[model samples]
Target: MSVDLQTVKRVARLARIAVSEEDAERMTGELNAILGFVEQLNEVDVSGVEPMTSVTPMEMKKRQDIVTDGNKAADIVANAPATEENFFLVPKVVE
Candidate 1:
């Protein structure tokens, strides 16, 4: 789609930007050029191209999902002033 001075000014107003008539007029051409490039890109055929994460291929780093320092429920609640069933008790603030 093409951009006009009114569209530029409206966008600036919605973004809370104070744009003058000169700036809006300038931005109208700039926005239209950018949209023209995007429209051109839509004409390219990419149906057979696969999605890629990077230009250079490399395996993603991973870590083992083994549990460590677990089964310490009682030890965790030992320092709390109030705890029940390994859960901290707090005063009810809502009614």
Candidate 2:
């Protein structure tokens, strides 16, 4: 419900931020204010609100989910030193 100087210093130390005593004192009030605003938000009635991906009403753009050979298999293997069936041929390194 509130932030104190010690909590601010501990948080700063954990975050690896260099904060002087004065800055820590200042952040104490700022953090408390932010937390207070968040607490206020918790009191709002939202049981009727539906979960949505966006604020504006719009349908999600979709495409057909289908599998197809990209058709560029031949083009992709064109520059290979050796290829078979549109696949790269590599030398077998293992005996």
Candidate 3:
């Protein structure tokens, strides 16, 4: 797809980027080149190719599903200026 100066300016404004006329012109050519490359890729035949996550085959490492706190309540409460019943004590703000 061909990108014109007005389209480049609009895209820059939407992205909240300040682009001068020269930079916008340059960007227009760069964007068009990227689109041309994508168009070329669309012409390739991939009828028998399988989708893959990685180039080489390898199993993903995974840990057992478990949920537990680190058991550092006492250590954490020790750092608080005021704590009671294993919880931080803060001043009441709502009432």
The TM-score values for the models, in the order shown, are 0.45, 0.45, 0.44
Worst lDDT run of 10 residues, candidate 3, spans: 63-72
Cα error of candidate 3 at position 68, Å: 14
Residue 1 lDDT, candidate 3, scale 0-100: 69
Best-first order by TM-score: 2, 1, 3
Supply every candidate's count of residue pairs whose N, Cα or C atoms clash at under 3 angstroms.
0, 0, 0
| Candidate 1 local distance difference test against the native | 0.90
Ranking by lDDT: 3, 2, 1
Q: How does residue 59 of candidate 2 score in lDDT? A: 84
Q: Write the per-residue lDDT of candidate 1 for residues 7-37, one digit (tens) a residue.
A: 8999999999999999998889989988988
Q: Model 1 — which ten-residue stretch has the worst lDDT?
A: 61-70
**TM-score, predicted candidate 3 vs. hidden true structure:** 0.44
lDDT of 2 by residue, 1-95 (tens): 89889999999999999999999999999999899889987788899887777988888988789865687988999999999999899999899
**Minimal lDDT window, size 10, model 2:** 62-71
